[model samples]
Target: MQGHGYAQPLKRPPDTAVLIFLRVLFVVIGFTCIGFASWAMMLRLAIVTRKSLDWGLFVAVLAADVLSIVLLGSEPGDEIHTAGGYFGISLLLGTLVAATAYYLAADIRHFQRLRDAYRAQQPMAMPYGYAGPASPYTATTVPSSPAAPRSPLGPHTPPPMTHTPPPQPPVPAPPQRPAPARIDQVRAELDELSDYLRKHDGHHEGNYEGGR
Candidate 1:
């Protein structure tokens, strides 16, 4: 299974040596809880393999550690119930759980880093035209041009252009009536009176006509 292209082993981190020490410590503690000895080993293997089942086993081991601490402090006999011994065992179990949790978290982070690096190293797929595969088997047909539209009468001829004259402005009509006849009669009367005065002035002096 490890031979698959995508199934390369995770690179060991700088803190792997510390994790190994913690794993050995956990195995020693597992001896105290014989029921959980197998489970503790399974949990370590799951961590190494980066399996989803590891979380369930980790929880089970944590619960087992808690129970072991409780049993140590609450044993039936007075010999096992010493305050100092109970406190020491409690401290050791707590440390084991803490170390296991730290290692699991660090391993998960390292796995994520490896996955990210692998994805970054992979070359992106080229688009359709840049360096695509040749298609020699496919037919290479040239597209045909569209035919010209035909007229119903005879050989196709463009419609004749007819010239349309622009509209002319309307002409103004003459005045409806001529000047009034009374104006012409008044002018002729004024000219006759001036002629009579000029003819009478020569016949009589001005002072003689006024005395008569």
Candidate 2:
């Protein structure tokens, strides 16, 4: 997960206060995830938002853990069994699935945020297909920035500039980047939208740091 340095960390993580008061509930849910989701979510928060926390994966796991409670709720003769039986297995699988999803989205978000920053700073610094170090993860399949509840204008590559012969360049110069005010407006709009999509979209939680 390279390139997540730009934005300020979130101020408050989701779903901590409620869980704090419901401490007794932890004993039941604790064994369900086997601590996998908590570990994964903790890692995300620790690595991601220095200022705030991120426990999205843990929440997803908690949702799955309720299934265990449903099993315990069953009466002696009820159709629901004393043990979770086959359904109990879903708890581990659910947490693992959540962990997998969190990693994938978080990693992609990290890469794209940095990629956008890099392209903005030095649009032509590296050739498109230079074949740098291989990444186990690739954005090729995504075909675009990570999806979100609400889509925003993208960090598209800068427009191409016209080239003239080396001895005499064209009279007209290439277009300049948008003004600072324009960049700020865009980031502001993006931040606003990203707040809404923080849970669903992986890459867009922070503010833009690089400037012209």
Query: lDDT winner among the candidates?
Result: 1
Distance from true location, Cα of 112 in model 1, Å: 0.3
Which runs of model 1 end up more than 4 angstroms from their true locations?
1-79, 127-212
TM-score of each: 0.31, 0.28
- How well is each residue in 1-212 modelled by candidate 2, as lDDT tens digits? 78868875333323445433333343334335563333444354335533233455445555665564455455455454544644654555555555555554654455456556655665356787787776767635445776644324445655456686678766997898889999999999999888868754544333333321
| True-structure Cα RMSD, model 1 | 12.9
Model 1 compared with the native: what TM-score? 0.31
Alpha-carbon runs more than 4 Å astray in model 2: 1-38, 49-54, 62-85, 123-212
